[model samples]
Target: MTLPAIIDALQCGTFDREVLKMLRDGGYRCVTPTLGFWEGTLESLDSLARWRDMERENAELIRIVRRADDIRACIADGKLGILLGYQNTNLLEDRIRYVELFADLGVRVLQLTYNNQNELGGSCYEKEDSGLTRFGREVVEEMARCGILADCSHTGDRTALDTIEHSPGPIAITHANPASIFPHARNRSDRVIKALAERGGVIGCAAYRNITPDWACATARGFADLIARTVDIAGVDHVGVGTDFSYKGDDAFRAWMRMGRWSRQLNYGAGSASAPGAVSKPDWLPSADRLSDLVPALGEVGFSEPEIAKIMGGNWLRLYEEVFG
Candidate 1:
């Protein structure tokens, strides 16, 4: 009856005491929270500094994960591993060398683009899919050298394919669903999923209701079905769960996430501006802690214990070992 060690591929918030308790009580061994979304270099540095202070204060509750072994260490100590990540490369700006700087600072995953095009490449929200630019190719090369896992969660399809083809190692679409099941611009197509698996990448199926076909009405079984569809294309080893849970955000923070000082007007990245509020989570899996509830739901969809273990956490552990080791 014991549960496997769970590593959430993406949880969207700066962890506070209550959030850490929720994750710990909920049985999460590790969680990847973005250090920089739309933040620049100085801002990201500040964020990391704050995290260091948090770790120092709550050493028993959580520890920062630098290597793949660090994840195991956290589990052994019964502490949550904070695998530092970035949802965008805006922190890099025009400087490709910052890849190493961030890597040295304990950042293990970096997303190429958010909702808009940057120096690296095009985003899903871009009017024209620019693919991976020359600068973006250079950034990918630097990321390989730095040993940081590349993520294309919010990137354009062409750009995601280009990243997979260009990277020396496997990349990640750490938080996204299959567009085949639900045709949102933020979702990945079957072509992208197949390509990702062929290149040894992992796609962490997200639980954000706005991206699902059922929207706010999605049930845990429906989310499991989405994972099942992803497994059909990518196989179980190349898929996992990224609930995309955000705890410490009001409507203002939500607005900042969608339109990060980029536009004077509201730019609803996934939701419509007309219906302005935070996107609703599924009733069954409302928080990251409820991730364990999906176990039976996955089973209902015919996933065996080992396969459910892989989808819950083992596959992501393998990926972290290969890429972060």
Candidate 2:
């Protein structure tokens, strides 16, 4: 049977022709290349610079997705569609207008916070979640108005629930797993998952080792089983894959992702302080080239072909249509 077009909801890394080739080989026709802003500053020139770089460097191999139709068009043309996304609203600084500005620049996804509290709301690691602040409510409204998805991947439980309650439209938790499966700060709870799904939102399961049950449960099959369980909770229509793959290997990149100038000391955010580096990924899904293995793995987990297709990519496509104009 022919597989459906695949869309990764969130991946963090640089994009180049080689990466595009791997995505194409993996049967991924569309993906969200999420870049993060950590400094909590209004200067988003760096994000713009990277967007321009991807446009210039891989113009032939990939096309930036601005509209829902662009995804299918890019896939039919054999070009990977890049859905520009941000993991934090720090780039917005204090101005709500920047939400529309970033949307004009083709940013389709925006997470309210990262691993720490921001102007919008608190993070999962915060001592106490402040929930959605007044500014956060304004940002959510503006994002919904501008067709930018409100993401809650790194947001605290209260903030995430608040987003679901206050947003005019559905919101997404783009890269997370179930806390019930693996008790981690980065994972979502059943309450959050059900609320998101009830609001017409989708949840993308992450492949990060720390979010999985253990090193043994980090395989492609294991990830598939996780998705299966998520489906049981959130329904198949609201579950998809967000690998959260960071294609960087340098120590600086690792440290930046963890601390990102937010702390002077080493903050082992996800993994252990002993390592503070990239954790070992499953052998079945080390990179985008291995993403295709998920299809059969999902089948092995007893998902019907149509259900597997939705988990593979259809659900996210529907979400983009509803949220991204």
Candidate 3:
């Protein structure tokens, strides 16, 4: 989850607040990512300055997770652990060596591209992805050397496949959907999804705008349902939770996303689901224990508890161990 979601839950929504309480109450720990905003040579802050400030300024149910043991300890002690991450390579800018710097900063994962093309490679929203660029190839190599998992969530199809096929270590699609179900440049094709699983990689199914079965997803159950569908396609052990929740941005931000602020027309001005069952809002940020509710949803589809566990967070844990340990 992103810092915006955390801050919102802690301050705005009672239900969200209770959701966190329920997770801890149920003995399941919530682990968050440190947030890869305001990164780069300290100049790129102009792009994500406000959001980064929210993460740094706001206090909430967050614990900075910088080590492998930190994750283990979070689960053991019943606290939500955070894994810092970057959604785009903008922060890295021209510094490919910065991949190692981020790794040292405890950035466990990185999405190569965001909504548009960048120095690394084309995004899923790009017009065409002709595999890895020279710089992209180097970035891939650097990430692997640094032992930080590469995320192709927003990468173009060709680039995504090229990186996965050539990666020296396991790579992941941190958050995405099946293009077969929902045709989208941002979604993964079945072939790509299967290839990722074949290499001990996990696909983090996203529950956001156009990523869902219908127009908008308003409930965590709906997101879990999508996850269950992905498990059916890729198997339970090959998929996990990577809800790409960024709820703090307003309508202007939405227009910027759709109008191609990063790339051209990347976001499409879609709103997220703030509450369950909302028609326009996509409930991207669900309660922390929202993962647990996936149990019954999957059960309705005939998935066992153990399988559900893998989809929830077990598989993610395994990948972290394999890559980081």
Candidate 4:
């Protein structure tokens, strides 16, 4: 079967030369590599510089995408287009003007919060969801004006809903699952999903273990079923895949993701002390190169050719066009 331009809406990995080759060889046209989780402005800026250096060093394999056309250009030129995204808005601090500054620097997407509440709003794990703060509303507006896509994947339900209502254009839940299916704090509830769809946003179904409906049986079929269920809730056009694949990270990285220097005590999110690291990736779709395996699995689960194409990358392309253009 002919494939569409495959875009991994969110991938957590070290975009090394090897990973870039894997993604290119795996038939990924464009990928959004998440950056700035628990990072301050200086650190995030350094990360962006590192990505730029990587793009230069591996010019044949990948290029940084700054506009909607860059994605198509990379596809035609046979190079992976990398869209740098911030997993949290902590980098912005109190300076709302930084939105346009980073946008100018090719930061196309930014999530309002990670696992903890920030100046913008509350996180999913927060005991009290502060919802969208007044500053958060301004941030959303500035993001819309700057053509930066606002993501609510790790945001509180109330904050997510408030964001959907406040944003001038469609936003994204870049990497998450439906709470109805997985019952995890990282997953979105039905109400949030419906509101996101109503506002023309897309939810990229995540393939991480803890959020999967059946983690022990994390097969391609199960992943496809997750996508199908999301389609039922948000329609096929608003459903896509965000693998959340972490190609290279140690236990330190995992701990940092959960704890993030905010606490001295370890915080095992989605895992306990016994399993104090990232949940295992699905056995079938485990890495960047193995993403194509989902095509057949999606077909097996009753997705039409066009629907599968949409879920694979077409939906993300449409969203990028609308938001990044």
Question: What is the per-residue lDDT of model 4 for residues 260-318, given as tens digits with 9 covering 90 to 100?
Answer: 88899879876767877767667887676777888888899898899888999888888
Which candidate's lDDT is highest? Answer: 4
- lDDT per residue for candidate 1 within 192-310, as digits (tens), equals 99999998889998877777667323677877887887899999889998878877788777877888888998677787756567766778877778888888888998999998888
Pick the winner on TM-score between candidates 2 and 4.
4
What's the lDDT for residue 208 in model 2? 72
Scored by lDDT, model 3 comes in at 0.63
Q: Which lDDT values do the candidates have, in the order given?
A: 0.87, 0.85, 0.63, 0.88
Query: Which 10-residue window in model 3 sums to the lowest lDDT?
Result: 2-11
Order candidates by lDDT, high to low: 4, 1, 2, 3
Model 2, residue 276: C-alpha shift (Å): 2.3
Off by over 4 Å in 2: 39-43, 215-218
Each model's total of backbone clashes: 0, 0, 16, 0
Ranking by TM-score: 4, 1, 2, 3
lDDT string for model 2 (187-305, tens) is: 99999999999999999998877777664245778778888889999999999988887775577877877888767987887887675677877667767778888888888889989
Score candidate 1 by TM-score against the native: 0.97
Model 3 per-residue lDDT tens digits across residues 1-325: 1111111011111113344445455444434432433245464344234334433543254355555566667666656554656666767878887888767766667778766677777877656776778998898888888877888877888888888888888888877788887787778998888889888899877656556666327665566667767877887788876655444455554454445333453235223344223223355345443445445665676667677666666787777777777
Native-vs-model 1 lDDT?
0.87
